[model samples]
Target: MPTVPRLACLLLVAVVAGCAGTDTSAPSASNEAETEYDAATVENMREGTYNDAFESSYEPLPATPTLIQDATIMTAAGEPLENGDLLMRGREVDTLGTDLPVPNGAQVVNGSGMYVTPGLIDSHSHLGVSATPQVGPHYDNNEVGMATPGLWMEHGVWPQGPGFARALAGGTTTALLLSGSGDLIEGRGFTAKLIPARTPQSMKFPDAPGTLKMACGENPKGGSGFPTTRMGTANGLRSTFLDAQDYRERWDAWLADPTGAPPERDLGMETLAQVLRGDMLVQVHCYRADDMTTIMEIAQEFAFDIRSFHHAVEAYKIRDRLAEADISASMWSNWWGFKMEAFDGIPENVPLVHAAGARAIVHSDDDLEIQRLHHEAAKALRAGREAGLDISRNEALRWITANPAWALGIQDRVGTLEPGKNADVVLWTGDPFSVYTKAQRVWMDGALVYDRTDPDRQPRSDFELGGPRQH
Candidate 1:
């Protein structure tokens, strides 16, 4: 059911905003006047001395202003608005309430009997790296060595893969596609906007903090290497952090006094140093409760923060401790007992963690699971309700949207349907909890990217032109 390639651009007015600057006063987009830079400054920029590159190149798909009326708007930040109107204008949400003044030439859609909510964000996914048509040639997720912190998952992503389109159709507007947990120190994971593009750079989320992928438990120990035992794995991790601490100190010394050339750049060591400086987010793959506790000890020893624990099936056992440490538990709704560490998983893992006052996130490491993240949350919500936890529908919705946004450190811009937030939204046919519901349309950055009714709007791959690709 793939649909279209990226269509031709349409001329539409967009209200742009200014990028966050270090200045005390935030400037607007209109105030971005061209400054005449000196020749020396231009030369420095050309030499890449000022800043890092690989910035976001995602532009809104060509679309006119859109207004939807008579729909239940799930703002996610607050209560749902019944029979409300949502206005998307110029790359931002204009307003969402009853009886809004529709701008001229705006396309008005009848959303009666439908529901609109903030676009879903998959906290964890492997759609792009381990793309569809799975085979030996397309496997780009895992690396050869155990320690690959310097490696970036985005570099290995195949943008033209059809999996992204299918994900978009399922209402996944954003995802943190990570490397598989085959290594101890996996790699740098990328938080990407799920838009079909020519390259990974075009899909990267702007200003998102870099994510460091580390793992504990069975997967790492199963490999035939130095870290084949739990003790060996823990010691190896501690040794890595100790080296990183020394690396951070040497860099600090060189920065304080530029006497000689800076210490020879160690890409892997530099990544670890950033973690030491609290610049990168540490997300670990640990299923067993004791392994998570060990990871917490390691974090304490190194003075780095653990943002979230991924695939932590046994997190419910230590929910209070996770809350005390302000760490999020990104777990699956029903995935249990696939391995030894994951054997203790329970159906109430998500809600129990949230009830204990910790950030509870539902993630999809599987491609098919990523397609219906809302339904996945519904499953957790039902289990919580059945167990007598007073969880609201909106609260359960946060598992996929807000909590994951917090985990990725992008909650300020997305995960909610606010006036100034990115207009990433999905139109659903019925209550999202209903198994019969389907995503009718999707928008990213206020651009119409997918429409179930229009073949020109739905995403299609070149490989789908002649025959079925997924089967």
Candidate 2:
């Protein structure tokens, strides 16, 4: 079985690489100068503006031209405001009050009986990798090497992927593109805004910090033949971080003496160095309690941050510790029992984490589930309510909205509808918590991206290009 998973992953990477047209060579460094570089310079060496990553088809629409009024707005901050009005302009929120100026020629969307709020954000997702039923080469979420810290998930993204369309229509405006969980150190994941375009770059959230995906527990160790145990996963994660720490020090020493020359740049080490230097966020996948605790300890040892814990089914057991560490729990609502480690999962995990004052994020690990993230959030809220926790619908909405936005390190840009924030908003036919609720209209960067009534707003991937329009 382990060999089967490994072979599947290998074939997936090969297929994805072939479809991508060409493989970008990893940056090389000489061992002779593999020491003595400044921290800033070493950091600079790792960060480069890639023209390919920025390519996208999304265009921003007039911000001040759309007005949604007379709706109950769940701010995801405190309370729901009845008769609230949200005005957007040029990719940012211009106003969010009952009394607001309506610019001339603005598209006044009648929200008389609707609900409006921040667009949903999925902090943990493998949509671009394992999109739908198309397995094999279409799925390259994990790298083959155990030390593939240098791998970037964005490069593997199938821009024409149909998964993005479904997520956008389902009301998710932003998502963190993560590599698969086949490896302990999966690779780099970036926060992306779901905008229709020709490339992934066009879809990425501008200025969002890059994140590294790490895993602990069964996915990393218990997979038939690899680590084969919990302790093995811990060792892999710890060793990687430790190496990163060393890499940072070597580069720092070299930088102190520029004339001496810089150290050799190993792609893997360079990636880990970025984390040690706080240039990247750490996203870990773990389901069991002991594993989670082990991860926290490793993070402390290296003094690196763990941005969020994804698929944390047993998170409720350590709610206080998670809160104290300021770690966010990016979790599934009802997903569990599919594997042995996840057997202890309880639906109340999210609510319990939130009640303890820790950040709680709801994410779509599945393509179908990604479309209905709001419903998943609703389920989590219901579970909490059943557990006697004081959770409001508006607060629960944050699981898919503001909370995730924060976890992805893009809160400053698109999480909330505050002035100066990106105008990524969703309009629903009813309370999003209700199963009957559906997104009537969606906007990203003040541009109308999806509208239930507008056929053009509906996205069609390259794969479906020649196929008959489903409509």
Candidate 3:
């Protein structure tokens, strides 16, 4: 017999040791059968392959103690610092101050005219699943059902998609790659560090919180499934949540007793159950204010929080309410009028929400748009300033950095140039808000991933008038 897998051996040992105490009642025919099944369930749970599977295997790239000197630093946590030195030791920001002493054995780069900020984040994106070549076979964003809480978006992610490299070159380090909202419940979203890897597992951010993708407006209803109308969609979702509650109760009862087999496993219901139990965050794709209100009511009934709403064009109308509930509005800067529900999109949506004391995230749902997320945030910042909101450049930068990081549940790890945070940072050639600026260098987890000055490190398709950046 082949040696038992390490996990299996440990699980077997636990089972033999009666960790939960195998049923001790007199073993009648039915009792024995139930006890055996219960033991098997416990073993599978311990193995972790039967449930809560596909754990991340991500490892940070090799890094060195490096200092980027004399740059304008926007931390996204406070006012910008001028002529500051940022030191990255190992995989985290070691220090940020003016005239910092260079650490021993640290490589130093002069960043005289560059601006450094936390790498941009897109809270709502479909980069890997939408695929770069844009062919039918490459497109794996949407599945065929309206109720597909069972499907996980990472399974469909094309790791080789060229978009990941392009996104990194554009200064985006982390992105929440969501399932296409073609289904009412398009399933779970995957948060990834934009690393070029062979599989999504390698790109997965370790210990990142999970999120589910749901839709309340036009996108989901277009599918040929149970929910063809908005009312139908609402009822369908409510019904699913009710079923998830029942499933959770069943599982809970088994854990409380462990005398019999647990309820039959359900791929779809299990995901919804995780949502109900608060193990997963829920982000919805909604445009109209009324539709968002409806989802809010459902959330209240279900006793779970809505993390954010993607493509919420009319989020401005309910900005106060959203702020009160602490729900983030992940939106495009100004792209609107392509559909009926999205027509109300105003350029000032992000800042208006921010002014109301709510988190406002600027996200890119399109592949091309993902590359210019900072530009999108800049546009919104200008619009908000023009509207007299008194927003600062640092605060506007948070729309693309800190706010989106919070939405994706990775704010503590990234979103700011602070000590004890991962060095996912971008060095820009000019003012990051200016259209003329380009990302001069990027470092993810302290590893220099892109350097525009180094032809070997730059992306091949970085696309200037010349083969390489002339500016």
Q: TM-score for all predictions?
A: 0.88, 0.87, 0.89
Clashes per candidate, residues 3 or more apart or on different chains: 1, 19, 0
Best by lDDT: 3
lDDT values, one for every candidate: 0.86, 0.81, 0.86
Lowest summed lDDT window (length 10), candidate 1: 4-13
* Between candidates 1 and 2, the lDDT winner: 1
Please list the Cα RMSD from the true structure of every candidate, rounded to 1 decimal place.
15.2, 11.3, 8.6
Q: Which regions of candidate 1 are displaced past 4 Å?
A: 1-51, 466-471
Off by over 4 Å in 2: 1-43, 46-64, 223-226, 467-471
- Tens digit of lDDT per residue, candidate 1, span 1-471? 232222211111123232232223535646665345555544333222244466678676776789999999998888899999999988888899998888998989899999999999988888778988788877898886667888888888888778888889989899998989888898888999998788898899987888899999888888877788899889989998888889888876755544434566677887888788787899999998999999999999989999999999999999999999999999999889877787889899999999999999999998888889989999999999889999988899899999999999899988989999989989999898889998999999888999999999988866557766575
lDDT of 2 by residue, 199-316 (tens): 6777767678889998877666746555777777777777777777888898767655664545687777777877887888999888988888998998888988888999999998
lDDT of 2 at 4: 35
TM-score for candidate 2, residues paired by index: 0.87
Cα lDDT for residue 93, candidate 1: 83
Quote the positional error of residue 87 for candidate 1 in Å: 1.1
